[model samples]
Target chain A: MSPSVAYGTDIDERTKAAEQSATDVLTAPDIPWNLVIWNDPVNLMSYVSFVFQSYFGYSESKAHKLMMEVHKKGRSIVAHGSKEQVEQHAVAMHGYGLWATVEKAASGNETPGKGGRQRG
Target chain B: MAKAFKYGLKGISGYLEPAERDLLRGLLDDVISMLESDVRENEDPLAALIGLDMDVKQPGDRALLRLLPNVMKDDDGGSLEFRQLTERSVRESKIGALRAAALGLDKNELVLTPDDATRWSMALNDVRLVLAERLDIRDEADAEHIHSMQDWSQAEDVESYLALVYNFTTWLQESLVQAMMAARQAKS
Candidate 1:
């Protein structure tokens, strides 16, 4: 039998298309990334607030507020910037034992995700 | 990123059921003054007195809860340092726990078998050793790490330095309310 087509698309054409798409996505200009720290079961609320205040220079009350939001909600998007900055942030956060990741900022605005909406 | 909320409703009740709040207030000042700063004697000596069924309760049962906020207040009057200290400590403590758990999850993580506990304890000790030996005072990045709730970047010794200073203070309002209940009980 000749190359069978996939149910969702023509398999041979789709495979070629998928490869092109992946490359296009990779080569796309960096849209800037965000540093997201998720709430966890191990860290103390005080500590999370502390990280924001100490590392990022957030005020005590402000840090506490952000920390509370993270505790109450599931996660908090901490910082926003270039991919390298975000990746570095994620690494630092990980080193500090926090669960962190970097992702492209949501379109339309560059606001850091402050617990309002989940980052894409 | 792990949040360990040790107490809930039951823990709350045990914390504050009697006139225990007053006794707690007494014990807290004693612990804080003794550990962090000097305590001046109160004119009414009985005012700060905190007696308890379980002597270990300090003044009552939740002295840690009462001190959380004050601990958050920066000695330098800057909240930035205060928040940083708190976050760094928790991160250090949790990382310590994680390394232990990573080797093998605790009973809660996997199943707290007798075997698991032994292994976990050993792993914890190992992590402690690594932290103690590897503290690169010269490295700003390494200096930033807090291994045992202490912020060495600020003063000195990584464990007792600020942790003890701030240990008594936390944001455990619920825990304090529970302690207050106990204080009232003791008074009654």
Candidate 2:
């Protein structure tokens, strides 16, 4: 399913630079944590994508990419933030019945999108 | 047979036969009961009221553990601390959704507002998850095996019955999510 055009926006260089600096600062002392969604046999692919789109406000392509990563790679770091932020997301993901866990970003080799802070 | 949920002028709507409604109601209630915590004797009333459950342990049952997974993958102490702070509220919200969906099943014709549809989807998903666990659906291969059990005549055993149920919920949730996506598109 295609997401609305309004939902998808290009990340410009200015935004990218700001996010890079923010990530650098956040990583220095408080290592950002990742909210990883693990793939399971039960959760519907559409439902997982919908949660990504609705809960995290990821665009359809972005959500589908993350969902496919989870399905193929066995897990995908869907979001990353402070420990508490990722923990809150973990709870919300559990509420949606998706298998989820939080980990310090350094603990895993894969880094999710740079400064992927969720919209409130 | 239940109609696949669809988004229309009246929002997301679906229809189910009485037996189907009863079946769904049973599933929703089962998940609700699984999530509901038992009252402890001489417990701290304030902590309970504030949704703290320091006594909460990692669920022993596989299905229950699936429902309320530990936050940290390797840090049990940290996970337990986070669980103490958040698990109670999570359980309450899950039970609330399960109960809401169960209450909606009282009628055969289901019309759902966005909120109702969200709760229904969550409830159906939770049902499917627990059923998957019981059916021992560990991987895609196991899921495919379960998905192949479509004929009612083949549901001669408990495992097959659960597989059928899991497939039913999976279909239902897929349709509901599609409708939700459509509704979201319409709004945007």
Candidate 2 residue lDDT tens string, A1-120:
233333224578668767878978877557568889998888889999999988887777888999999999999999888888888888888898888999887754896853344555
Model 1 over residues A1-120: C-alpha lDDT tens digits? 022234466688878888977975785446466677766443445455545644565555766776777777766667766665665555445444345655566676545643221122
Interface root-mean-square deviation, each candidate: 17.7, 1.7
**Model 1, position B141: C-alpha lDDT score:** 34
The prediction achieving the highest lDDT against the true structure is: 2
DockQ by candidate, in order: 0.02, 0.66
Worst 10 residues of 1 chain B by lDDT: B51-60
TM-score of each: 0.30, 0.90
Considering the two chains of model 2, state its CAPRI-style docking category. Answer: medium
Cα RMSD, model 1: 20.0
Model 1, residue B23: C-alpha shift (Å) = 30
Compared with the true structure, what per-residue lDDT tens digits does model 2 show for residues B1-188? 89999999999999999988889888988888788745467879999899898898989999999999998889999989988999988888889999999889888889999999999998898898889889888999999999999998998999988888888888888899999999998887
Model 1 misplaced stretches (Cα beyond 4 Å): A1-31, A108-110, A113-120, B1-188
